[model samples]
Target chain A: MNRFKNNLTPYFFIMPAVILLSIFSFLPIIVSLGISFTDMNLRGLANWSTINFIGFDNFVQLFQDKVFLKSMGNTFIYVIIGVPMAVISSFVIAYLLKLVSDWMSTTFRVIYYIPSVTNIVAIAVVWSFLYNQEYGLFNYLLSLVNLDAIPWLEDPFIAKLSLIAMAVWKSNGVSMLIFLAALQSIPKMYYEAADIDGANRWQKLFKITLPSMSFATFFVVVTTLIGWLQFFEEPFVMTNGGPLNGTNSLALFIYQEGFQYSEFGYGAAASFVLFIIIILATLLQFKLRKSEDK
Target chain B: MDLKNNFERAIVNTVLFIGGLLVSLPFVWMILSSLKNEREVLSIPPTLFPNAPTFEHYINLFTNLNFDVYLVNTLIIVFFSMVGLLLNTMAGYGFGKFQFKGKEIWFAVVLLTMMIPGQVTMIPTYLILNEAGLTNSMTGIILPGLIAAFNIFLIRQFMVTIPDDLIEAARLDGAGELYIFFKLIIPLAKPILAVQVILTFIGSWNSFLWPLIIANEERLYTLSVGLALLQDQNVSNYGLQMAGSTFMVVPVLIIFIIFQKHIVEGFNVSGIK
Candidate 1:
């Protein structure tokens, strides 16, 4: 009995958390999986009797859907552009800041991170003002250079680029600090050894710093990829996927389908597509990491 | 060589200073524009300083837009989220210190769940909440987010660092499991928990998409959702939107300032993926 009770103790401690995860995390996965194959919409959602389990119909339709295709293309663009922007810029900033004095670096880190923690709605609002056509700051600066005031959000392509620019600003802070931590962990002797060997900045950077930073690079790349694939909040607030669905992302498409248009089945299918992509990427990362360790 | 090094250092410092200014300029503009009147905000070749700082937009956020209620609503949700932190710390402690059946498998499940992005599960969660008759309630929004896998993983990592012997001593002293968790683990895990709560506070406070969907009813809206509404209400009212943004921005800024070190550390901890 005592042994049984001792064995039961950990289960008791973890029971509530498990229950919460079941209701929110684990169960939802299964439920969404089931929902994806059925025709569950605003009308059918009310009565199970009305719901149709049209096997793979929603999944089939999602492939042929024009808006879905556009959003998929847009998400690909976001991940492609946004991920490199985050990785490369943060790498450069982190490398440069590590050269500065401690106080100065910390100050800049705080400044950059301020946007990361700020409410997204607030940042979108402030950015919308800066991106405003006639009276905005960006255009105001442009006028000083005798240039035209470009429509930042009114044009489809430009709106996508604008969102990408904001994504870089909002995300780079955390990635930079992560890179800084990676930089600090590198052994100093490598740099000193390079100095003794009379290595140039470019060679030492390529040969030493870049290799050492690979771990952090891998981390930032994977996370940023996952994040950009779900890019919603910015476009939701900024463009609402406007200018002919140009800024629509996969996650945003899912949101509008499920909530706005009440196309829950379609939304679930799109979500599963994203889910599969994320899982594959993560598994690939682990596999690569294991092989690299050898 | 010395002169070149100094020159390089100076150039880097100047570049950093300028970068810092650029990073901070939008926020400065947000606050300054918040203080200006309607006409003043839209003036071409906008002045850095407000011609006449007015409280009208701020006043309108409360009186016209019903912002105070949303602010309170945000606080309530954050409070629930923070309360759930204790529950997370408890489970984390169990996973960290206790030897049990299926320990590795259970912990693996927690880690695996992190890979499942919130998007995939979002619809099912809404359905679940709707079935529970919670769709329009604040509980619907707060319940699904009560405890995240990330929080559990982070807390478990912190709890494992507390020497096992200390917990063993407590166990030997005739203390119950609950007592050990409450008295021993809780006190020692305060720093990690503080860092987590700060992150969760910002996360919960700023979360938009969840709040927007789960609580479509205006009264149940959080401040971020309310700010979005304020934006949509007057698409071109920069002054009003900026003022509303200020209220939303200020609390987060204050908390971030107070816990900047821990906040940065929290991001670092999460990056350990």
Candidate 2:
């Protein structure tokens, strides 16, 4: 009896999390996958008998969905532009931060980090004011420079960029902190040795800094890529994928379809597509890193 | 060499200062605009400082907008965070210390779940909640986010570093497992617990999408959702929006200021590990 009780002890400790995850996380993934193959709409949700297993029809329709395709393209544009901007800019800021005094660095770190901690809705609200075409800060500044007032979130193309800009600002702090941590972890001896060899700052940066921080860079890139792929909140709050589905993201598309339109099966299909893309992107990054190692 | 170094330092400081101002400009503007009257906010040649700052919008938020209710609703996130922390810590301690059957496999499953984005599971989760009559309720919003896989992984990583000898010694004294966990493990895991607390607090506080979806009723809406709705309803009322934004942001900013050290250190630990 004692041995049996001891054997079950670990299970007792872990059971709560296991149960929660199984219901909320694991089961949902499987169910969502199953739902993707069925014509599960609001009626189907209401009456189980109304649902039909439609096979690949939902996936087939998703491919030809213009809005879905537009969202996919917008997500790609976001990742393509936003990822590099986030990674590179944060890296540069982190490097620059390392040059400053300890107090200054800490102060600036907290300042930059303020946006990340604040609620996205609040950030969106503020940015909307800033992006307001009339009596807005951005346009007002442009006018001061004798340039024409450009629509920040009004034009479809510019709306996408505007969302990306806010996202980059909101996110840059976290990656910047990560990079700073990475930079701090590098051995001081490497730099000393480089200085002994009469290496310039650029030479040392290329030879010592970049190579040493490769893993950190990879981690940042992969995480940022995954995050940008699921870009939702900015567009949801700011544009609602506005000005002709310009800022629409795959995640937002899933939300609008599943919750708003009750197109459960279609949304699930789009979600799986995104899931596959994220897995592939992550795997490709890992593969590239491995090849680089060789 | 000293002069050159000082010159470089001056330039770096200047650039960072400018960057800092630019980064914080929105926040400053949010607060400033919240204090401005409706007309003043939309005035041409936007004023940096309100000529006669008023608390009318802030007052409006509390009185007309049900912000007091929203604030109470937002505080319920604390309950979710606390419950999640307790559950994740228990699981973490189990995974870290125990040599149970299929432990490795179960731990692997937890890590694998981390890779699956929340959106993929969102639809089915909502359906399940709706079926259970949990939708349009605070319970619905709380249930889905109760156990983050990453938190379990983080706690487990921290717990594994705890010495096994201590546990063995406590067991030799005939201390029960639950007692040992409550008495010994909880106190010792303070640092990781602190990290988890701040992370979950900020995460739950700022969470928008799930709450927005689950809470359709105004009374149940979290601050994030309420503020979003307010923004939509009052599209051109920049003052009201800013006031609402300020109310939503101030608690987080205060928490960040107080816990800045732990917040930064926590991110460093999570990012590097």
Candidate 3:
């Protein structure tokens, strides 16, 4: 009886989490998946029979859709550029911070990290103002420097790059903190050994510092890539996929299709496409980890 | 050799100081712009300091824009959601402490849900809330987000570190399961709770997408949605826009300033530890 009671206790404890998870997370995905196979539009919800089955039609349409294609392309550019910039910048910052005194280090770290901790929406608003075409601080400063006010958010190509810059500014600090911790974890013995070998700072950095942080490098890259793929907040709050829709990302595109256009079926299909891509990327990361372990 | 090392350290410090200033310039610009006259705010060379700092925009937010109403709404949602989070945490502790059949399967199911993007069920969720007549209500905002898979996973992982002997002692003292959780587990779990609460509060406070979608009434808008609208409301007024943006970030900024150490520790503790 005691043993049985022990067995029941764990289930009782986890039951609430199980219930909430089912309702909020699991139930939604299952519904989205089910709806993806059918031509379920907003108007058809009132009429049960109107929701007809359309297998892979939405997916095929998404591929052919021009805006969807552009959003996908923008998302790739964001990941490729934004992730590396954030990672390398943070690593260098963290490394430099490590050499400073404790108080100075902590103060600088806090300053760098304020953007990460502050509300993204607020940051987006401030950044949008900074990026405004006229009477904006960016352009105002440009005039002082004898340069023309390049359309930060008004031109398609410039808008995409602007979004990438905002993404890096908002996110680099968290990566900085991660890299700082990894830096601290590196054994002092290695540095001492490098010193004994008469290795200079640059040589030690390339041979010891970079190689020692391999795990952290991998973790940061994978997480940053995952985050960039789901880039929504900045574009939604700042650009709204405007200026020829150059700044629209996959996640923003999903929102646009579903909420703005009421293309629920097509939106669900696109969402799942993103879901599959994320899963495949995650799996590839895991495969790399497995091989490294071997 | 010592002189050379000191020289190198000085260079590193100088580089870091410059980098830190560049990183923080946007925030400094926002705060200064908020206090500046409108013309100065839009001027070329972007004055680094206000000629005459004023609180006109902050005053306007409360008097004309009903900023208080949104603040109250944000407070209401955050408070109630925290209450619900307490319940969820207790449930998480129970799951981690006790053993039962189907445990692995249920936990796996929870993990699986975390992988799915929130966009998938957003429409259905809106539909469900609308059908339940909860749209435009604070319940619409708080209820859906009260419990999270990530929070449960976080709390449970922390709980697993608690030794079993403590629970046995509480049981021997005739303490009820709920009593032990409330009395013992909670006190010990303060560190994790601090991290979770800060993370949860920041997340809810900054949540724009879901709130923008569900909240129809301007009065019910959180700071995030309110700041977004401030852009349109004060379209040409960069001063007011900066003021509103600065306002939106103040609470989070204060919290982060106070808890900087824990905030960094929170990230490291959650993952790398």
lDDT of each: 0.86, 0.89, 0.81
lDDT of 3 by residue, B147-256 (tens): 78777777888888999999999999988777888899999999888877887788777767777888888977987788888876677888888888888788898988
Model 1 reaches what TM-score against the true structure? 0.96
TM-score for each model: 0.96, 0.98, 0.95
Work out how many backbone clashes candidate 2 has: 0
Instruction: Write down the worst ten-residue block by lDDT for model 2 chain A.
Output: A96-105
In candidate 3, stretches whose alpha carbon ends up further than 4 angstroms from where it belongs are A1-12, A289-294, B1-4, B269-273
The predicted structure with the larger TM-score, 1 or 3, is 1
Sort by TM-score, top down from the best = 2, 1, 3
Instruction: Give the C-alpha miss distance for residue A232 in model 1, angstroms.
Output: 0.6
TM-score leader: 2
lDDT of 1 by residue, B112-181 (tens): 7777898998998999998999998988888888878888888888877899888879878888877888
Summarize candidate 1's per-residue lDDT along A1-294 as a digit string, tens digits: 766777888888787887788789888899999989988998877888888889988888988999899999999898888889888988888888889888888888888788888888899999999999988999999999999989999999999999999888888778888898888777889988998999888888899988887788888888888888889899999999998999988899999999999888879989999888777877887888789879
Task: For model 3, name the residue pairs that clash.
Answer: A10-B98, A13-B94, A13-B95
Candidate 3, residue A99: lDDT: 83
Compute DockQ for each candidate against the true complex: 0.62, 0.69, 0.59
- CA shift of A179, model 2, Å: 1.0
